[model samples]
Target chain A: MNSAYPHWKKGPGPMNSISIAFASGKGGTGKTSLAANFAKFLSHEKNVLLSDLDVEEPNVSIFFPENEKPGSSYNSKITIPEVDLNKCTYCGKCAQKCNFNAIAVYQDKISIFQELCKGCGRCSNICEAGAINLIESEVGKVNEYSSESLEITEGILNTGNIHTKSLITDVKKYRHRDINIYDCPPGTTCPMVESVLDADFTVLVTEPTPFGLHDLSLAVEVMEKLNKKFGVIINKSGDNDHIIEDYCKKGNYDILEKIPFDRTIAEKCGRGEFYYDDENYRIKMNNIYNHITGKIK
Target chain B: MKKIAFASGKGGAGKTSLSMSFHKYAKDNSLFADCDVDAADAFLLLEKEIQHKKPFYSGLKYKIDENKCIQCGKCADSCNFNAIKKTDKYYIEEFSCEGCSLCEDICKYNAIESRSNCCGELFISDTVFNTKMIYARLIPGEDNSGKLVHEVKKIAHEQVLSAEKEFLVIDCPPGIGCPLMAAISGINLLVIIIECSQSGFKDAVRLINLSKKMKIPYITVINKSGLNPDIDNNIEKYLADNEIFSAGKIPFDKEFVYLLNRKKLIIDSDILSGNLKNIFSQIKNRIEMEK
Candidate 1:
């Protein structure tokens, strides 16, 4: 075990865990790369539970290939209301109560749009005649991958499925360890919010471009609004890093670390290979880990 | 009129940059709509002067009156989202509240009142390039971004019909989720931007799968090519195997990032402009073929 950090379980087991979520408002900003590498680095001493909450396109597991073997997985389901025609009075109460517009009533006929439903059960609960019955519908699957060093739980959303939040919640409920790292989905919407809501700290990753700065600002606003403690990690940092540095300085946000723009790193990430085998990369990850544990502890 | 939307399942995969460049090249014959409400940046490059704007009220959230005599726990127990909390006074966590109004319906004292939230603002503006644009700004941390994207598209579609525009170019949000689905609806074609990285390809494939499932015909563009030859070859193989058409490949260029930092479009760059021209022409040809 690492002498500096407190010792905990050596694998996926229940403990007083501190979760850190790596998120970005813009896509392709190295959230998964940073999250995966950090989790692997931390797992050398303490038990680390890494979760891929980017249900839409989870790529964290791609970096953890175990001799081309598959992980143990199970389907996750959400409840959507189904109207019973016999009990239905066609009064339009359920339709009116649905904020998502998933249900509609017209001229003694009812329509249910399953895709639009959020599975909030409001329509079923509001149905006075007991016509609306909530039914289980599979949205995605939660897969668990384990090795001697680390444990990973990934949420894979079924194609055309929009229930990203429910599936993310299911993945978060799976397991925990000494330290949890969540690779959040891109964008500052519900899915991103759900991913970061329960994290002890959130690391906002970004590049040093205008789009990166803009989206990073939006993500900063979300973290601030949610009252989450967060810092910034500038990936692909180069000469134009002032674009983000100036903004971070103005906002007094902590610049945890920067991963320089290197072609070798990009190639390694493109091939889904770990680039943390070098001493320089290990020091950077250690700095971030120490910074986060120092603050949260 | 042909309406085409550009989307990348991964963020920062150059969807907005490419769409802006396409709109610039297509010139006055096209209109642009920024449907990525969560992180709308089309206006940054388009240089727009807002002509008309309005607050968009998406849904309602129930607020409990502090003076109401009843501090009943029924509302708290009934909320599936666990948004309701009784700490000195009954209150709702605005972030988690879905605005279902079940609490408002059950409260006999009429303590809860449904308040429509101004989740975002919609704008109809004219860009410096003489192109009319429609965009929206969703308040940070607010829900209903998908609904806002739909509203922006609906208006853009109406304007395209009324003004007799030849094309409606849309910039879609990343990820094959609700917002992307909303942006894809009613669009004649989808331009899937694939960043030439393993993560980018994986995400782009997800978006391609979604387009296929929705029966939306699309063309792919592999951006930031030459970053890795292996990834490039793999992407080519996958596209060839699936018989999917690709618009073209864009080499990895630092100039694109500099141009973006300057709030300039690809058409404004001397180096990247030529490649964008070819891509724009190919996409335009595809859209024209649809007619």
Candidate 2:
């Protein structure tokens, strides 16, 4: 039965299988819960990898308790420039070349905001004098937890650290095998863009309310700008909230699925579990997986 | 003046609605700022027209001068972000570049130049409730959200001085990331609004840990209460274990959402207003004590 579903593989080519990212401009519409449950649901038939790119607050790993016993973790480091005062020429070339404003030069001293430096190597490369040197600093960690068929790879940003985008990119270094589901961070910021930009298909999880409608529009605009194929999945649909449907009809967007608003489901969410214990949603997920893989072909 | 910000690491944890009620009930000369620039909704609920707007320039970004490029491919090789690309001609992918200037550093031919990019816009407005509010919006696919958050706060402070407000209530974006940090930096108090759900507790803990690290005086007010008795008890136990003082709690209500959709504050219109008003004042007293 697991093999009954077709793998989202490209024919004799170098396509990195199928990667689907779940994103929403607004937070707390159950993006993590949906991603977590759907990842397990798809793993029943597919080699699914759930990567939590919401480094600031990764909740997907909360659902995978079996894989909780001390997984192999690695640190993420960024090589920021450390200036050598002895070899310094106050040429101000390095200061002018830094786009992040991480460097500023005065008549007597040069000031650098270390956290602002992205270690892009420009400061070192542009230094006319041999003053700038790069030093690696551990900023975040990427951990891999596997149990049976499912694997959860989460990017955990160290507090007071501001390298979310780069660490999110680093977390993707673990992507291998069939289908990869990236649980992206909320908002349409650069970090979310980085995670959802190159996917085969994207699932924009939204609820049917005014806030949902507003943020969904922003997410839609981003997906359109990236030229990526995407559809909407209303996570907490209720009878009164038709704002999402009204806009989707006007924009002619494809709605993948609508998980009706259920109190039991939400309570289950609180417990890091899905509400429906039966195969009701498994069949729905199968349809989604089939449609996306079919689109790839 | 005492400044307070409401931040929950998880979204939809009742930041904006709670801020509105707190501002109304706090009854001080309050300046409300929405640092949730990623998805500002306090304005939506305020039902106010934009009083003022200005483009926010984060910093300088570089672009290739297709004319000066020798297609040496050297800048692309030196680039760590893989921003420099080659198709018809070598061009810089705007979003990919972290504005590191390494490309310009490596370009010996002087083909790359830098200029200010409009990363976002800051706005000044007043709520129908007669409270002054300042908010900002980050343009889609733009970088430097943390910088924009700072700009919004700066405007908020300026507004506070000019308007002679005594209290500053900031509505922060979800997450313990840079934006929320910028929103609450050097504030008088940190009033965290925690929802009593399991995910809510998990998300709130991340932010609580952040506040503890920043060494800010803080309190917690649980929202969406009476959802499930078992979950609620667990939340209370966790709050007690952490010794994070609970200010008050608001029972879950559906009418609140319907009213919010219409841009109305529940504190003024709903039957739950009495309970919410009580919670707001209790939270207000805690702020006063902290102040």
For residues B96-213, write the lDDT of model 2, one tens digit per residue.
Answer: 7887666766688999999978888899987777778899889877788888988888888888998887888999998887788888888878888787677788778888888888
Q: Is the docking of candidate 2 incorrect, acceptable, medium or high quality?
A: medium
Put down candidate 1 lDDT per residue, B54-89, tens digits, no spaces: 999988877888788489877888776667987887
RMSD of 1: 4.6
Q: Tell me chain A's TM-score in each of the predictions.
A: 0.92, 0.90
lDDT of 1 by residue, A1-297 (tens): 001112222354465679999999888899999998898888889989899999988999778767244567777887788888999999998888788888989988999998988777878788889998888888888888875578898999999998888788788877788889999998887889888988999999999988899999999999999999999999999988998999999999999999998888988887788888899999999999999888787
lDDT of each: 0.87, 0.81
How do the residues A164-183 of candidate 2 rate in per-residue lDDT, one tens digit apiece?
A: 88888777765555888899
DockQ of 2: 0.53
Give the poorly placed runs of model 1, Cα more than 4 Å off: A1-15, A67-71, B69-71, B86-90
- Candidate achieving the largest lDDT: 1
Please give the clash total of every predicted structure, in order.
Answer: 1, 0
DockQ (Cα-based) per candidate? 0.56, 0.53
